[model samples]
Target: MKSLVSSEIVEPYAQALMSVAKTHNLADRFGDEVRALVSALEGSADLSQFLANPFIKVADKKAVLQRIVGDESHPFLRNFLMLLVDKGRILFIEGIGKQYLALLRELNQTVLAEVVSAVELNDAQKESVKQRVQNITGARSVDLQTTIDPDLIGGVIIKVGSQIIDASLRGQLRRIGVRLAA
Candidate 1:
């Protein structure tokens, strides 16, 4: 699902950061590092709050992040964090991270596919689903993330990027109801 934070706000920051990473030949590395940072922030509410709090000094927050990431961290990533601090964008890091990953996936010719099945998909079922998604979307590959939703009753719902293919029994029933009403 798309983030509530507007792409207007998120994309520019991600694009600028992607440019820097590309210039350094470190797009994949920086992407991984940013994912780690987002994971860390998500794992700790206090740390996230510390970075996002408007009353706190940006320098102090940068110092804390630097200490946590250590001296061995990539200079580009360190500087990127500092840039975020300077621009007062530290709080939007999660959205930035999402955009960064999305950019990376697009660069790699992979589409993120979210699948919800009435029952957990087996390996063969998963491969079939992925192949169908690939054929439909014309993506070179599908990065499939699956969830089980018993309320669906049967079949699966597929979401690739913003497009959804709803074949679940519940969805079928809804369509039938609409047709009957019409």
Candidate 2:
């Protein structure tokens, strides 16, 4: 599959970046930078397409990166961006950033939990979800990402890695329907 190949290419680049972050004792800083870069890529389809366009010149891509990252970014990260451009692997930036963040989470013993609810959760509810995730994964901490989906009607769904714990009212109704049919 395309994703299999992407992962193959992405892992090494992410690990290499992680190695550099560890060497500089800037794992957290690099993680933040990667998150920001990924956010930017996701926020702008044109920018993402521009970086991935094979017809675009490398210098142009590098210039765009320089402009986006600016001179304030660490020299290592700036060089890393240039290296990706030079190697014609800029298309994998999003995947590489995600993989790098995953690696950082592993190193830090934290789990990323995606929570979907019918309504926005308050601080107390978020803390409760975090505690539940920590209990489920046995991680020292949980990075909670919350989203609202009103179709759920009520309750919440928690996803950590491949695991999904669906407590939504719709899920419950579906299960009940299946049970009655069976």
Candidate 3:
């Protein structure tokens, strides 16, 4: 069950839901709702347990999810939840939400950029990094996630989608070493 809950397995489901949301012109709303659902699952251990417990019947889990999400929940999301309950994939909901958001960003021409630096970045530095990523990726906007890794020694490494720009001192030194060995 755990192995089956990976992003690869969950992506098709997210893609299907994204199609429905996009067709109905509710992509943003559905994206927000999915994020909220993920947040709820993270915030409530009991709720997460209940959703992932196979011993609980599917009907019962669907009812509970309906109550939790309320009557006003988006139809696409509500039906999507029921489908997950039916398919015994409740545990993969978080991955589905993450995948859905990634799809949404792609659809909107935005990109998620990861920046790893030797030291903590100030607000200005972070903004500059984000702007550079946006320009390089041709993304309308860049959602940046920053991390500090002293091993980097200096400079930063940026990752946007499938591409990586490694400017870190560690990477440079490693490249130099490899060239010298050759």
Candidate 4:
């Protein structure tokens, strides 16, 4: 699904990033780097403030990013960050990360299925569940985001994209238990 980020504003940057990523075959890599940068910015109030500083030159901010995230960050990521800093739009890095993921999901035709269970599934079991989801969704591929929630009581609550399949005992019990309690 398209994100809330305006394509008119983001397309230019996304196109630029996409070209560089295609050249390096690192679209996903660049996205990961963007995410890391976003995390770093969010984790440090001082750093975020520094980036958002109106007086800071774009070159200086770029230098700061290079110093922090290091040279391994893809060139596109470096430029993208610098561009935002230059334009005084640094605060939107978090939104950019979210938009980047949305773009990645679109390009890959992949959807995230959140699997919340009472306990962690073994690797094999997780793969099995993924396969089942693929079969049901008719999606050639699926990305599973798994989490362990002890309060689930049992079974799994499969979130197929934006929808949820809450079969957890806590959920069912809440429905029936409510009837009984009433």
Question: Which one is best on lDDT?
Answer: 2
Q: List, residue by residue over 15-114, the lDDT tens digit for candidate 3.
A: 9999999899999898778877887887899998999899999989999999878888898799999999998888788788888988998888889988
RMSD, every candidate, angstroms: 3.9, 1.5, 3.9, 4.1
Instruction: Order candidates by TM-score, high to low.
Output: 2, 1, 3, 4
- Where model 2 places Cα greater than 4 Å from the true spot, the runs are none
Comparing 1 with 2 on TM-score, the higher-scoring candidate is 2
What lDDT would candidate 2 get against the real structure? 0.94
Tens-digit lDDT track of model 2 for 77-123: 98999999999999999999999999999999999999999999999
* Backbone collisions counted per model: 0, 0, 0, 0
Model 4 misplaced stretches (Cα beyond 4 Å): 1-16, 19-25, 38-64, 178-182
Tens-place lDDT per residue, model 1, 53-151, is 999987798999898677877998888788888988888887888889889889878898899999989999999998998999898888777889999
Question: Between the candidate structures 2 and 3, which one is better when assessed by lDDT?
Answer: 2
Candidate 3 differs from the real structure by a C-alpha RMSD in angstroms, to one decimal, of: 3.9
For candidate 4, the per-residue lDDT at 72 reads: 84
Please give the TM-score that candidate 1 achieves against the real structure: 0.74
Question: RMSD of model 1, in Å?
Answer: 3.9
Pairs that clash in candidate 4: none
lDDT values, one for every candidate:
0.87, 0.94, 0.88, 0.76
RMSD of 4: 4.1
lDDT for position 103 in model 4: 70
TM-score of 4: 0.71
